[model samples]
Target: MTQQPAADPFPPPSAPPAQQFAVPPPSPSGRWQPERVDPLPGTEFGLVQLRVMPITSGLAIGSLIAGIGSILVSFLVLCFGITGADSGWGGWVSGAFTLLSVVFGAGAVVLGLVARRQIRRSGHTGQVRFTGGGMAISGLVCGCAGAGIALLSLALALVLQVSS
Candidate 1:
């Protein structure tokens, strides 16, 4: 007896197939042209253009960093002074940090000024426009604050030494 193949439980549909999407051929320049897609019914679409933003000044960034470092070192000096740890090696360490704070503060001030100037002059010579004027200002402020604190701490230390 011949074994007949089991009858299929689900038969293929005899309905017409759905439409298929085709990709457009690449252009002569080897770049694929963007395909425009139709929006759904009752939907509105707008063309999108790429926009370029101005770059930030490196000097501004450096200034901000230096200013923050100066502030931190100044705080360290304050902490050491408050903790009465300015004896022997601690004193030397504190002094070093104070000096560092001053240096960093000065550097931050200089860099911030330079960065602001550069930002102002950006795009004048066909160069990319620079942003970060606010950063430069903040850096300058922080640098001044840090330097002031360091100087005040030094003055207080001196006064205490003189009194003793």
Candidate 2:
């Protein structure tokens, strides 16, 4: 004999097909429900925290110091000029100032070269953010100032003029 069709062929009609969306924690209204979603894929984001922000901070600092040193040398040069005219120990003082100027100038040049190298490196690595370039430029200023002062002082003291 053929069997009769069951009252409900489908599984006892359980809760709505495993709702992709799940019910939210019961709200005061008792009807709150939340929808499910998957996290965004492929698209990603990154931040450049710069563990050490490495554009040779010391080089920039050295450049800045050198620039300021140049201004100091210029002042010393003026002093040397005034002192050298009087002769005696004044000449000695002038010589000292001139020497100081030369030293400071050379230091600034060295620092500038270093800073320029750093700037190049930073641009290559893409980390430097704010002040290295400015400092390096200042170093150039310092070098020029120091050289001018020292040379001018030397010329005055030794009469190295072209004698035109």
lDDT of 2 by residue, 1-164 (tens): 99988786566534433332233234576433333333223323222222223444577678668767766866766666555555534455656777777777778778888777767666333344334777777787877787787667756654522221
Cα lDDT of model 1 by residue, 87-142, tens digit: 43445545777899999999999999999999988764334689999999989998
The CA lDDT at 113 in model 2 is 80
The segments of candidate 2 whose C-alpha lies over 4 angstroms from its true place after superposition are 1-56, 123-131, 158-164
Question: Looking at candidate 2, what is the lDDT of residue 31?
Answer: 38
Model 1 regions more than 4 Å off: 1-52, 85-91, 161-164
Write out the backbone clash pairs for model 2.
none
| Residue 80 in model 1: lDDT | 66
The per-model lDDT (C-alpha) reads: 0.73, 0.60
